[model samples]
Target: MSSLLDVEVKETIDQKTFLTFDLDKETFAVEVEKVVEIQELTNITPIPNAPKHMAGVQNLRGKILPLIDTKVKFGLDPIKETVDTCIVVIEMEVEGEKTLVGTLVDAVQEVVTVPSAEIQSSPSIDAKFDLDFVSGMFKKGDKFIMLLNLDKTFALDEGDAADNKENQSHAKSKKS
Candidate 1:
């Protein structure tokens, strides 16, 4: 029974549907299983002393969801909201806790099923952008979509550090 269950789990992991989206005109994908839902751009309350990448927080069905600007996180210019702009709500484990984070994308594309076999390891290069956030690359026709490791891409420790620095700055300012 255990062996059968293992095989089933392996099969499930071998191929997964990914939610594709556009960031800075480039295609990117995140595993669909992590996606909670997609939402239209709405009013987000600015968080005091939050990181620059953090767009702010939104009230989602009574829960405050933190929003991350994907373009800013990727070290690109912040996106100018358009009709196509939307948020992809994703649930990820942060510091062993399940957290829901909204990722702001330029636009969302259709979901696509990609086999794990087809994903090629991202090449290590000395680029301005951090490649650790990328899990792999998927080729579709003439374009290659970057597969993002959502967990690593939005690590809570980085946010915490940013918050701490902001708080320290605020405290120093108040003292003056």
Candidate 2:
């Protein structure tokens, strides 16, 4: 029988680095190359007429960056900020434009190198998350980490007038 370390080494020969983070106690990873930086929770200014999943925008350096609540995007409960909460800055192509966005995660975990052979295709099932966003899955010890296809996962489309109006109204209510 092959030892666990041997199996990992064999599988990790052609590995790619990924930055792992926690969301609702689940571990998810994104390619390290796509990640710009990781920051602690910062004040987010609400935006009018934005989508529900949009947490708002924040000033990163001098540039404004749109923030997405990963929990809300996944249809999970909003995160209660703690010391571990962080914002993961990522760059991706959105609507043919390169965009920098911050993703709110429960906690930022360590960077891991996962081998291509270790990744398995995501199963199509009645999962809480849209399986389309999952590129693959791999095991780290006994825990499985879902690899996210950032482009597909963070794709945001222009909203219709009614939806924009509704979001605008919701934002107004929150300010009161």
Per-candidate Cα lDDT values, in order, are: 0.88, 0.87
lDDT of 2: 0.87
TM-score of each: 0.85, 0.83
lDDT, residue 117, candidate 1: 88
How many pairs of residues collide in each model?
0, 0
User: What is residue 164's positional error in candidate 1, in angstroms?
Assistant: 5.0
Number of the top TM-score candidate: 1
lDDT of 2 by residue, 1-176 (tens): 99999987876667889999999989999999899999988889987677777889999999999998888878788888999999999999876888899999999999998667888998888988877779999999999899998876687644434556787788789999
**In model 1, how large is the Cα lDDT of residue 82?**
97
Residue-level lDDT tens digits of model 1 in 1-176: 47988997887879878999998878999989899999999897887777778889999999999999988887889878999999999999887889999999999998999778889988898755679889899898899898998877787666658776987798789989
Residues forming the 10-long window of minimal summed lDDT in candidate 1: 155-164
lDDT of 1: 0.88
- Candidate topping lDDT: 1
RMSD of each: 4.3, 5.1
